[model samples]
Target: MALPEPGADRRTLDADRATAVPTMRSAAPLLKTSTAGALLAIAVMVAATVGAAIWLSIIDQRRQAQEQLTRQAHAAALQIRARLIETEQLLLLEGSGYAASADRFRRDMEELLDANPALLRVELRGRDGQSLVGVDAAAPRPTVAAATRTALSPEAAAAFDSAARMNRLTYSRPYYVTFGATGFDLMELVVPTGAVDGPMIVAVYAPQRILDHFLPSDQ
Candidate 1:
C-alpha cells in the first residue's frame, strides 16, 4: 500500500520508456522536414544564379554587335573619303590644262560619272557657290527639292549650315529627291573640292539605290 521510492527500478523504467518514445517520434519528423527545406533552398539558389549568368551573357553579346556595326559604318565613310580625295587630285591635274578648252574637263568628269554610276550627280561649285556643271547631264533638276533646297529637314539644314560656315565638307542625311527628268530618290553626298591650301567646296550626290549595298537587310 505504501508508494514505491522514487529511485526504485520499476518506477524509473516506466518513466524512461515514456520519455524515449515521444522524443524519438518528435525528432524523426523534425529531422526529415529540415533536410527537405535545405534541399529546396539549394535548388532555388542554383537556378537563380544560372538565370542571372545567362542574362548577362545576352547583354554582353548585344553590346559587341552594336560596336561592330559602328566600326563598319566608320570604315565605309573612310573608304568613300579616300576615293573623293583621289578624284580631286585628278581634277586639279587636268583643270589648268583644259582651261582653254571645255572638252578636257568634260571628258574627265564624264569618265568619273561613268565609273561610279551609283553617284547621282557631281557638281563643281565655284567659290561663289555656283554649280559649274553637273556630272549627270541627263539627270533633270527636281523642282520639289530644288538645288536651292539644300536641307531636306530642319536638322539636315542646321547641320549643313554649321558645316558651310566652317567651310568644311558637309553631307546630308538620307533623303528622297525626284529627278528633274525622272522621279527617283537620290541620297546625296557633298564634299569640299578645292586646293588643299585654299578654301573650296565640292558637291556629290548618290542615288538611294546605291545604299542597298551599305544597309543591312531587316531580317
Candidate 2:
C-alpha cells in the first residue's frame, strides 16, 4: 500500500518531458525571427551612416578646390597690377630723358632694352605722330588706330583715349605678337610727358615675364 509503481512514475515523467519540448520548440521560431529583424535594422543603420559621411566628404573636397582656384586667380591679378606699376615708373623716367635730349633718350631706350629683355620695343611719338626715338626698329610697330579698331576691345580703346587726352599713364589690353623666333602676348603702355601736345612714350611688355617671376615653374 505504501510503495508506488516504478513504471507508473516513469510514464508520468516521460509525459511531462514531451509536453515541455513542444512548448520550447513553438517559442524558438518567434525568437529567431525577432533576432533576424534586429540584425537587419542594425545593418541598415550602418549603411545609412556610411552613405551620409561619403556625401559630406565629397562636398568638403569641392569647397576646398573652389577656394584654391579663387586664391590663385586673386594672386595672379595682384602680380599683374604690380608689374604694370613698375612699367609706368620706368616710362615716366624715360619721358623726362626724352624731353631733355634726343641722344640721351636713345641711350636710355637702349639701356632699358638691355636691362629688361621682357620689353620688346620702345617708341617715342611726337605731337604730329612722328617717331622721335625708337628701339628694335625691325619689330612690327604698334599703331593706336589699329589698337582702337581691332586689337583692343571698344571699352579698352575708350579708356585708352580718355587717359591719353588727360596725359595719364595707361595700358592697352593684351595682344598677340611674334618677334623673331619668340612669340607671346604683349601689353602696351602709353605714358604722357605732362605736355598734352608733346611727345609720348610707347612701351611694349611681355606678360609671360611677370608670370615667370611670380608663379611656380610647375604651374
Candidate 3:
C-alpha cells in the first residue's frame, strides 16, 4: 500500500485502455445510426414537400381553366345581347316608313324571316291589338295586313298594349310553342312604331337558334 508495483500500475493502465477502446467502438455504431436516421428524416421531409407542391400546382391549373371558361361564356352572352338590340332597332326603323305600303311591309317581313332562320313569325299590330301585317316564315305571306283577324292571348295583348302606352319596345314573357318544332320556347319582341298610337312590330324569336348562332360551338 505504501508504494504500488510499477508492473501492477502498467497492467491497470493497460486494462483501462482496453475498456475505453470497446466504449469508443460501441459509440461509433451509435453515431453512424443517428446520422442515418437524420438523413432518412430529411428525405421524408423533402418527399412530402414535393408532393404538396404538385398538389397545389394541379389546383391552380384547374382554377385557371374554370376562369377562362367563365370569361368565354361572358363574352358570348354580350354578343347575344348586342344581336337582340340590333334586331329591335331594325324593327323600329322598318315601322318608320321603311316599308310604306302594305305590300312592301309583307315583302320586308318575308325577307326578314328568310334572313334570320330563328324568327318564326313577324307581325305589325295596331295600338288596339289588331294585326295590320302578319307573315309566317313557314307559310306564305298574308294577302294584306287587314285580311286576317284573330284574338291574341292575354300575354301578347298585355305586351302590345304596354309597348304602345310606354312608347318603347317591350318584351313578352317566354312561351311554349306548339306550332313549330315540338317542345321549344319562344320570346316575342314588340317595338314601338315611333308614333304613340301607331302600330307595333312584333317579332317572335327561337331561343335555341339564338344561342346556337352566338355561343361557342364547343360550349
Candidate 4:
C-alpha cells in the first residue's frame, strides 16, 4: 500500500473531531437534566422527613400537658375532701366553745368564724330557739347572715329537737332564707353542747363560699 499522505491524515483527524464534539454536546445536556431531577427528589424527601418530625413533637407535647392537668385535678380533689373531714371532727369534738360565758362564747365564735371561711353564722340558743351568744359573718354585708335569728324553719326546728333529744350533732334539710337583704340557699348544723336537755350550737353555711374557699384555682 502506498504511504498515507500527511494532508489526508490531517483531514481524517478533523472529521473525527467534528463528530465527537456534537456527541459530547448532546451528552452534556442529558447529564445536566439527570442531575437536576435527582436534586429535586432529594429535596422533597428531606421536607417530608422534617414535617413528620415536627408533627410527632407537637403530639408528644399535647399528651404531656393533658397528663399534668389530670394529676393536678386529682391532687386538688383529695385536699378538699380532707378539709371537709377535719371540719366535721371539729364540730363533733369541740362543744365547750358554746358552753362558756356570753362574752367568751362570742369571742370563741368570732374566732371560729374567722378561721373557717365557709361558715356564714353561728349561734348559741336555748331549746326554744331563743338566741344567746351569736356571731354573724354578715358577709359582703349587703345582707346579714344573722346570729340573732329566733324563728326557725320547720326543718331547722326538727333538727334542733332531735339533737336535743338524741344529745348528738344533727343536720337540717337544705332551705332558702331571706332573713336579711339578700337571700340564701343554705343548710344548718345543730350541735348539742352538753346534756340532752341543755342548750345547743347552731351553724349555717354558704355553699358557694365553701367551693370558692376550698377548690383550687382554674377548677
Candidate 5:
C-alpha cells in the first residue's frame, strides 16, 4: 500500500528472476570441467599413438631377426660348397700323384670308397663318357648326350665329359647321380687333374646333407 510503493514489487520480482537465471561468472567451474574433458581425450589419443609406435617397433625387430637368419642360412650353404670343392681338389691331387694307369686309379678309388662310406661316388671319366676308374669297377659306361658332353648341363653324362676338358681345377657346380639313371644337379664337384699336357677328370659325389646339416632349423 502506499500505492504498493510504486514498482517495489516489480524490483523484488526482477531480483528473484536474476537469482533464478545463473550468472556468467558462476559458469567458470563448468568451463574448467569442459577443459579437463578435452585434456582427457587428448591424453587418450597420445596413449594410443604411443601404443601404435611400440607395436610397429616390435614388428621391425622381428623382421630384422628373420632377415639375419636367412643370411646365415645362405652363408652356411656357401661354406659347405667351398669345403666340398676343397675335398674334391685334395682327392684329385692324391689320385694323380699316386695312380699312373686305369688299374692303379681303380684301386685307389676302391680304397677311398671303403675308407669313407660317406663318399657316394668317386670316378674318373674320359671325355667320351667312358669310366676310367670308379667305385663300382665293373659298372659299364653309359653314352652321354652330345649336347651335355660339350656344354654345362644338369645331365650327368654331359657334365662329366665337359668337366674332363677344363684344363684348370674346375668344379662342375653340383649334380646328382642315380643308379642306372641320369644325374640331377645336387652338390657334386668335378675336378680336372693329371699332367698339364692333357687334364684328367675326377668327379666326386657326397650326400647333399652336407649342406643341409649346416642350414638352420628354420631353413
Candidate 6:
C-alpha cells in the first residue's frame, strides 16, 4: 500500500474520535436508565424484605403472647387442681370425725375454714343429698339451712350425683356466688365417702385464689 500524508492520517483520526464521542453520549442515557432501574429494584427488594421482617416479627410476637397465656392458664389449672385435692383430703379427714362428736366436727370445720380463707363453704351431705352438717364462711356457725335447699344448679346436682355414683372426687363447673360483699365465680369439689348409704363431703372454693397463686397481681 502507498503511504498516506501525516495530515491526512490526523484528519482521519479526528473524524473517528468525533463519531465515537456521539456514540458514547447516545449510550449514556441507557447506562443511566439501567443504573436507575437497578437502584429502584434494590430499593424495592429492601422494602419488601423489611416489610416481611416486620410482619414475621409481629406474628412471632403474637405467637409468644398466646404461648404465655396458655402457660398461665395451664399453671393456674394445676394450682386449682392441687388446691381442690388438698381440700378433698381435709374434708375426708373432718367427715370421719363427724361420727365421733358433733362438737368436734364443727370445731374441725371451723379450723379448716380458718386455714383456707378461699373456702366459701363446707358441707357434709347424707346419701339422700341432704346437708347434715354445713359450715358457711359467711356464717361460720353450723347451719341446717343448706340441708333443705336443693341443688345450686343442675350442673351442681350432676356433679354431686357423679361423685356419689363414681365414689370419686368430682368438681362442678365454675358458677357465680356472692361471698361477703363481692361476687365471683367459684367451683365446688365433691368427695364421696365411698359408703353408698353414707354422706359425701362437698367444699366450695374460690378460683381466684388459684390464679393469685400462679399469676402476678398485675396480670
TM-score of each: 0.57, 0.60, 0.70, 0.61, 0.55, 0.68
**In model 2, where do residues sit more than 4 Å from their true spots?**
1-20, 99-120, 136-164, 173-187, 205-219
Model 2 lDDT tens row, 1-219:
688876999999999999999999999999999999999999999999999999999999888887886787678678767766766787786676686677877787777766654576677766544566666523332222223222334434544565568778877788765545655677767787666577777776666766665654332
The alpha-carbon root-mean-square deviation between model 1 and the true structure, to one decimal in Å, is: 7.3
Which lDDT value does model 4 have at 88?
Answer: 56
For model 5, what is the error of residue 148's alpha carbon versus the real structure, in angstroms, after optimal superposition? 17
Q: How do the residues 1-219 of candidate 6 rate in per-residue lDDT, one tens digit apiece?
A: 988876998899999999999999999999999999999999999999999999999999989988888887877778766866677776666555664456776777778777775676777777667777777765542222464345555656789888888888888998766535656777788887655567787777777765655653324
lDDT of each structure? 0.56, 0.68, 0.75, 0.75, 0.59, 0.73
Better of 5 and 6 by TM-score: 6
True lDDT of residue 110, candidate 3:
82
| Candidate 3 clashing pairs, residues 3+ apart or interchain | none
List the candidate 3 regions with Cα displacement exceeding 4 Å: 1-14, 17-40, 110-118, 128-151, 178-181, 195-197, 216-219
TM-score for predicted model 6 compared with the true structure: 0.68
Q: What local lDDT score does residue 87 receive in model 3, on the 0 to 100 scale?
A: 77
Task: Flag regions of model 5 displaced more than 4 Å.
Answer: 1-40, 101-119, 132-154, 173-187, 196-211
| Candidate 5: tens digits of C-alpha lDDT, residues 1-219 | 346788899999999889866765588789999999999999999999999999999999889989998998889879766765666666667646534576766677776555433354556655455555555422233223333334334545445555565555554555544435555333345556665534355444445445445667663
Model 4 scores a TM of 0.61
**Per-residue accuracy of model 3 over 37-143 as CA lDDT, tens digit each:** 99999999999999999999999998998888778778989988877777777787767773356787788888878877667778877777777777887543212
- After superposition of all CA atoms, the RMSD between model 4 and the true structure is 5.4
Evaluated at residue 195, the lDDT of candidate 5 is 54
What's the residue-level lDDT of 179 in candidate 3? Answer: 39
Q: After the best TM-score superposition of candidate 6, give how far the Cα of residue 4 lies from its true spot, in angstroms.
A: 2.4
Write the residue-wise lDDT of candidate 1 on 1-219 in tens digits.
998776798888999999999999999999999999999999999999999999999999888888787787777667666665665566555444433345655676667766554554555444444455554534433233335443234444543454546645565665554445665554444344334323233334554544444544433
